[model samples]
Target chain A: MNARVTPQDSALIRSARFRKEREADWRRLEDLVEKAEKNGLQNMDFAGTRDLASLYRQATTSLAIAREISLDKALLEYLEALTARAYLSVYAPQERLGGLVGRFITKSAPQAMRRSWFYILLGFLCMGLGALAGYLLYLENASWFYVFMPPEMAGGRGPDSTTAFLRSVIYDDDHSSSGLGAFATYLFSHNTRIAIFVFGLGVFACAPAFLLTFYNGLILGAFYALHVDRGLGWDLGGWLSIHGVTELSAICIACGGGMQLGMAVLFPGRNTRKEALRLAGKDAVKLAIVAAIMLVAAAILEGFFRQTVQDMWTRYLIGWTVGFGWLAWFMLGGRARQ
Target chain B: MRSPAADVRKAQRLARKDRRAERGRAASTILPPEGVPLNLPVASIGVRLAAQIADVLITTVAAVCLVILFSALELTRPQTIMAIAMLLFFVIRVPYYILSELAWNGQTLGKRFLKIKVVAHNGGSLSTHALVLRNLMKEAEIFLPGTLLLTLDQESPVASWIALAWVAMAFAIPLMNPYRQRLGDILAGTHVIHLPQPILLKDLAGEAKPMTAAKPGAKGFAFLAHQLDHYGAFELQTLETLLRAQDKFMSPDVHARNRRTVATIVEKIRQKIGFADPIPPARAVEFLRSFYNAQRAHLEQRQLFGDKRADKHHAADETPQ
Candidate 1:
């Protein structure tokens, strides 16, 4: 036997002793983790899950002791990693897909939109300004329409194009079924892209979002001008009314969501910029989703109803009814007890 | 003597101090609550960037393959092609991130490669809601502006500048934050941390010999049952770490330094435990070794009886007055 045991010897002895006592449980826990990692926690039976939870608690206790006492670096590291993995496995939040979708639609999305009404209004004002500008510019000189609207987007619907051609494009069902489907897809994708752009660009202090929203409105106004200059304003209104109410509203709401994010960054009240942004994002993202939903509704209307409904009055009636329905839903949807 | 309540309070205070000191040492990383007891190290910006680059490269390759595939299909209508393109972007690319993160437990392929994982800031498991929110935000943060400028409007100087600005802001947010959380991470209450390095257990055969031989009735300092109860596994492990460091310092001067350290530890432990035995400076190491053995045996026995102590403080609280 050694005459005098050095602290080094003592420590080594203590570690050995400690490890010997705990190694069995640690090994058991490690084996469980390995099994869970391979086959997932679902593979474990009720008994296995219970055992895992008990073992995890024990391991966590062991980790706390190891950390507090400053155990051997390797053992400490092992416990830390093991406990973290176990915690993740044990406490993972599981939600059903249907339930999640239901919650989003019924409660979260509408609540978020209602909360950010100021931004939505601002988005509408910007779009309105853009539309007015586009209208005035195109009215003064038809050449301005070319600057704002790309040829591909115009699709031969320019100032130079005859009134009959423009009216036919909106009202006539001469195009083949496949051709209509393609047109609907094109219109839906184009509008969806703009909606996404308005929402995404809001990160840059809402400037780009405002510009994009206004640009969308400008295109709409220029198109309106093209029809109005040729005494087809009422016919164009009926055509646009079929889908424009839902589509434009969706765009405005998406832009509003973007503006909310920008507002959070610019005016963080009592919270850090990050905290503000995060809180704002909870609502903003919901509005964007709601906008996307509206876009889909609009796409269906634009695709099917706009092409089929030749009577201007019926189109107006359908458009106004759908628009009013959406307005009521937003204003009253998901309201909590006062 | 001290009253039992006083003893409990002192032990609790010491445990709290230890935790505070640990937190102070790792101030750069955000720690969960004391109840969780996790010590996660935040992944550095460089590692995060590398992981992102890898992901982007993978997605770009996939996008290219898709474009080629679609081109080969030779769909007659431009609308059909545009529709396919939109579907590819929204369905394939977006869901790739969401589903992968969900399936892989907060690690994408790139994150897995770098040994970094997204974890909940609250020390809970990653929730589905968080996964969906974060991945959905990715479109706004990185992909949307990128696609708009690079593919949609390469000719527009204004659009290009706006995209560049957006990208710059996206990158800058994480850099400015202490936790290195991007917008999505902040919104979702998640952050990426480097996975702990794998632990390789060393050969403890030689170390085990002395411990086994110096068992009960061995030539070492004797401890009363109460003294043994004063500490738990925590103190035992601390003593072990101190002893293990001796092999690193082989010089005589270092040996002298180790003795001083050993004596200091012995005195502190003796006072804390209220041990009245007078231990010689030369036999400090022997006393610690004997105490450690007795404590380990006591803890193991208690564990078998379903009365396990979490640490020294916990052991103290369990001691009969």
Candidate 2:
């Protein structure tokens, strides 16, 4: 209703609309460009807007005459405006902040998270179950508990299997060098990898991922419960958390990917669920790639740092520091600058 | 490019035609006609491009921030905890956007900042389920044959070529529309629109002046008679109030008082103008436009100067010039 149609006003809606209209024309354009490139047309200079419009019009008219055109007048006009807007972006650029802010606001904050929460929680719950299952399996044969802890702790001890097991989990045989650092590093990486698996499974992936997650969870729970029963829970908890924070975040990312896929499959909006699932699966893979990096970092931390620190207080300090550091970095750093 | 002069002339003619019609209607009857909203203005190429750029920058920053937060936990902690944290963030944050845009009329934080809204072509907000469904459709929006088309060879199979063709078409739907749309919009039967301020009385006055000068068609006269009969005196007051207090106008509820006031005025106007003929809404608009312009001119002139004094001053001003 406004008396003007400024090129500026039509920018945002153009790309999507252009894709819809002239589907054939766009394909043709891409084809022509590609063909031209193949034929060494890269350096060929083209004319201005007038030429492009005429060419486009000719193509569109031919399609219309052949009764092959699908777009209506209203849609066509919309597409034209959008196309004009798109052309401007290539020639005269805008600030990057605008683009960043737009994506953060539109794509990341709410909708993406909502679509992916279920698998995350499921992954968490599965880990606990996994830990518990491991515990029960250990209890079935008490003599085998030492074997479950690791190989090194049992090396020197002829009796006192419990002592041997603790040694293997927390320290080395030499006692000159504590294994706490190594164990911590291993735990961080191991947990993160497990988390990744749980998350990346998606719906089909989610099932196995969840099972693995639950199995790990149960093992952790049972191991801790056993330690508490022996009055070593505090030491264990402090020792474990040093790298747990980062490792856990990685796992959650995996679960997030899985959830996205599951949701896509379960609720495909305009398309069939199968199609949705396929798309979600690809995105999940992208997510998993990122998750893998986190898992690796967690592994290094667990293997090196956690196992080396012996004093419970010192361990707690390091654990809290890393945990809070990550928290502050993610939640506060970007926002504080803004 | 099209001739700038031609475009300008065409726009002016359209404006003039609208103005004259408005004046004609106002002169014929005391009652004013209901106003129609203007078409949504298209977004410029620059803004659309900015929107894309914004999306990428925002996601990267957010991801970086999330990574930093996850780094703080002690190495000794169970790996599962980090896993949980990641899962929580991803699940809660992602879909919230898609749902909000679909349900609240395409207004996520970014869209809201951009000042655009989505609605059904028929003009209504989407429901929660529809919003949920739309969000889920991101799979298609993000993936689909567009990617495949981009990668395929020129001499691909007919089916492959056809698929590429289909996605290409889907993508263009929005551009072809006054309201830019893509395939999802077509499938969902929705449109995006820009909301602007209401039209002013001056603009209306300018539009109406010339229409009343033309010879009246029988259809126009008949419509005028209908307006006078259905809405007469009271409709005038309501319209005047609307125009005078345009800045402060709120959508008043249709209670008996308002309904009766408007109805009585409409009836009076119809009786006075006697526009009872079968003319379309577009043609009928001409009469009201002319009437509005004449009325506006008369009122402005009266307010601007006292009759004799104003004329003597005008003569003096002309003499000095």
> Quick one: best TM-score, which candidate?
1
Residue A204 alpha-carbon offset, candidate 2, angstroms: 1.3
- Cα lDDT for residue B3, model 1? 100
What is the Cα-based lDDT of residue B154 in candidate 1? 53
* Candidate that scores best on DockQ: 1
Off by over 4 Å in 1: A1-12, A38-43, A136-143, A172-190, A335-338, B1-30, B33-36, B44-79, B109-114, B152-154, B197-321
- In angstroms, the error of model 1 at A84 is 1.8
Q: Model-by-model lDDT, in order?
A: 0.75, 0.46
TM-score against native, each model: 0.72, 0.35
* Ten contiguous residues minimizing lDDT sum, candidate 2 chain B: B29-38
DockQ of every predicted complex: 0.17, 0.01
